[model samples]
Target: MKTESSAELTLRGTKTESRVELTLRGLVLGVVLTVVFTAANVYFGLKAGLTFSTSIPAVVISMAMLRWLGNTSAQENNIVQTVASTAGTLSSIIFVLPGFIMIGWWSGFPYWQSVAICATGGILGVMYSIPLRRALVTDSDLPYPEGTACAEVIKVGSGDVADKDSVESSGKGLKAVLVGSLVSALFLVMVQARLFLGDVAHSFRL
Candidate 1:
């Protein structure tokens, strides 16, 4: 199947309109996901000294939620994930900033100062990165693994099922996702329970 480019989709009026992409429902869902992911990231970072990317999980959750809500579209789901992932990333500030307090740099986190620091740093990063967008994303042939995976999820979730084969294919895809999720969950449980060695090297001593 041929994929539509942004310009082509716009010309064909197939792209999502601004109103649809910025609906109240989508924003509300984004805010909810952002809060949950941010809190989870903060807790994980504090305890484990690390946090995983939230983009894939946010995208999957957004797609599933929007699909269940009905009348929602892929662009709306994208918007929701964008908002959520931003919050997830920003939560990393909690990882380092608290060290200042622990080291007696401050008695507590200053609300306005923290906001100012984060906002300024984010703005500067965005400004500096804007010039490299084309070179990094468009000109380069780099495989953006996370981005590609999220796009695949969107494509599968948004596929039209006007025919029997398409319906069957979508069903298979859904089953694959469900099975993968279950397998992952089982592996995590085994690791947590110490039933499975998380690191083979450690278990076998190289």
Candidate 2:
């Protein structure tokens, strides 16, 4: 019996989110990552049938770049990561479009047909995921390792992991990231020069 009219309801003292939460710098960073990731992924996938995950990389890069912006917030970096991750997660159309040509199903690029197919597939995927997410994610205990790891990265970058030790740990975290990047870069360069193999696949009869 405590129902109140619409006019009586109020969020009287709620704090408003910062305007910097979705600033132009965040959008620009997201756009840059999106284009770079999409192009690199498409090329690498077609060439080697392998594509790197963008979610954590986008989050890490956004945090690093946004560190120079005094006004940047965790929400802004989340937006950037989400936008860039779309390139890696939502570009499944690439898998089929190229296959059509390779399989001789299409002699050449059919622009309109490709567009329609991609649009339909994307829409269906979105709609289907709504229910599947609830079932497999919301109601279930299935461990989503990538999502969990990304959240840990976000917390560490935002200093949400610790109040007292944040400053000290942050420097250590940056050092670890730099060392990992350097090692990865050197390994990739050697792989490209054929001094090492990126992967090895072996098969034998059972």
Candidate 3:
């Protein structure tokens, strides 16, 4: 028996065309999102040595923005999200790149050198992923927690998921994420403003 994946079910009847998927607007949005996310990723990585996945956020933002621009298709937003996520994720190179500066290997980043490094890294990643697509993503049963979650986000945004229960569950998940994000942002703002200490440390002998 050929078991269908949740992604197959969610993406049913959603294939419009490759032309729409590669529209000028979609490409422009993707580039804009890439710049935004890469900058944010570099900043966060350098500051805290941590970077969060921007895939779901990019998907959600793409869907919302394209909807506002007028009639939009899932394929277009897929391009937008893919570009943004790939660029943002790969920008983690900042983690190692900065070390060169810190170790006095270079005084400042040379623009062409950084560009070449990023381009080569991105190309190698794509080359490796092409071979692994079937073995890891298609044939394997390994639970991809983050990939699954991002798919659910896209499914809910697309509103064409075949399973009613899946749509409802994904909707709930999206709402939870929104509420949690708002609360966390508020708390962070308060902490930054010194409304309350974000951490407390006291030395005592006991």
| Candidate maximizing lDDT | 3
TM-scores of the candidates are 0.65, 0.65, 0.71
Tens-place lDDT digits, model 1, residues 179-200 = 9769967988999999998665
What would the TM-score be for candidate 3 when compared with the true structure? 0.71
Superposed Cα RMSD, model 1: 6.4
Candidate 2 lDDT, tens digit per residue, 1-206?
23322211211111225535677888899989988788878877877777778878887777766775665565676778777987785565677787888988999888999989977886897899898765665556556677666656665666555634644554455567679869978999999999999899899999
Name the best candidate (by TM-score).
3
Task: List the candidate 2 regions with Cα displacement exceeding 4 Å.
Answer: 1-24, 162-206
